[model samples]
Target: MQLTDRQNNIIAIVKNNEPISSQNIAKELGLSRTAIRSDLSLLTMLELLDAKPKVGYYLKKGKKLTNIDDLLEKPVSEFMSSPVSVEENQSIYDTTIKLFMEDVGTVFVTDTEEELTGIISRKDLLKMSIGHGNLKKTPVSLAMTRMPNIISVKKNEKFIDVLEKIVDNEIDSLPVIDNKKIVGRVSKTILLQTIMNIAKKF
Candidate 1:
């Protein structure tokens, strides 16, 4: 969408100091909160912004094939998700609800000591339910894909490398690992957002 000079200015401010709240933007721009919110909503709908709830909004990053190539040659942690994990044995039903509620497609399955055991996805649960036809009696472990061979990305890996893994493997995400433990998940959504962030450079 075409942006007005004022809108461009707002984007610039956010780019410089992102994760700033609507109220803060309103005060800084000397505009009404309603106006700021309107701008933010429009920008977000346009996919030019991303809000992390309590973390506020950030400029979406975008990248080209060349950029992706360069990214693959760089460190992965540059855009990796922060470590966030959930325990294993958390029923598939509950886990499904949690994934939807959290707006994440996958969650790492960990043991009591937080060691990675498996990876679970909404699709995995759906497949299990549709085929085995029973979830009430099935544990997440039964539906989870075991580890040791689970795909993963290191914090220092690059986006291109991760992209190759995802596209070539037809998987939605890769768990970020360190010392054989899952620290986070890298999904297509996060990759898209990182690309949007790069686009804002225009």
Candidate 2:
């Protein structure tokens, strides 16, 4: 889980002071002592910190670091990437050009309300191009891989779980779905980028 900005500031205080009370933290940050109680509770809950009744909060530096996989057992919400999408009723010709302009391997298709309905891949467009179809008259709804056929990830799914789905299915990316609506995307490229970022810490 990613730390909130306020939580980070609390950690910084505990780190620098070695053992700081919630009251002192509130005083330093100009917040009420009660305001920081939940922050301390959350830090403790995540195992980044520990506290005693009188001595106050301290970083859990003596504890062993989590296993790599455990460290990465976070939600896709932490590593979500902006998605590329097009409306389902759009002309296939315009959608094809937009696909190239967006420079994505696959573009999600949405209804007039911008709710995800399907997807159109470059391969799909290529096949259509070779068929000598009338682009201006063809609707993307006809060419798209429609609803119920779309493979998508969820906001709360473990990040690695999403990556596994991508590799096992041999797909380029999966849209991040939340309560049946598309919110973001996770591509193979984005997954690689995340791995590289984590590698830098060691």
Which candidate leads in lDDT? 2
lDDT of 1 by residue, 49-100 (tens): 8789888778888711223445447666777775445677677777777777
Off by over 4 Å in 1: 1-70, 131-134
**How many backbone collisions does model 2 have?**
0
Question: In model 1, what is the error at residue 186, expressed in angstroms?
Answer: 1.0
lDDT of model number 1: 0.76
Q: What is the lDDT of residue 54 in candidate 2?
A: 97
The TM-score obtained by model 1 is 0.61
Candidate 2 has an lDDT of 0.84
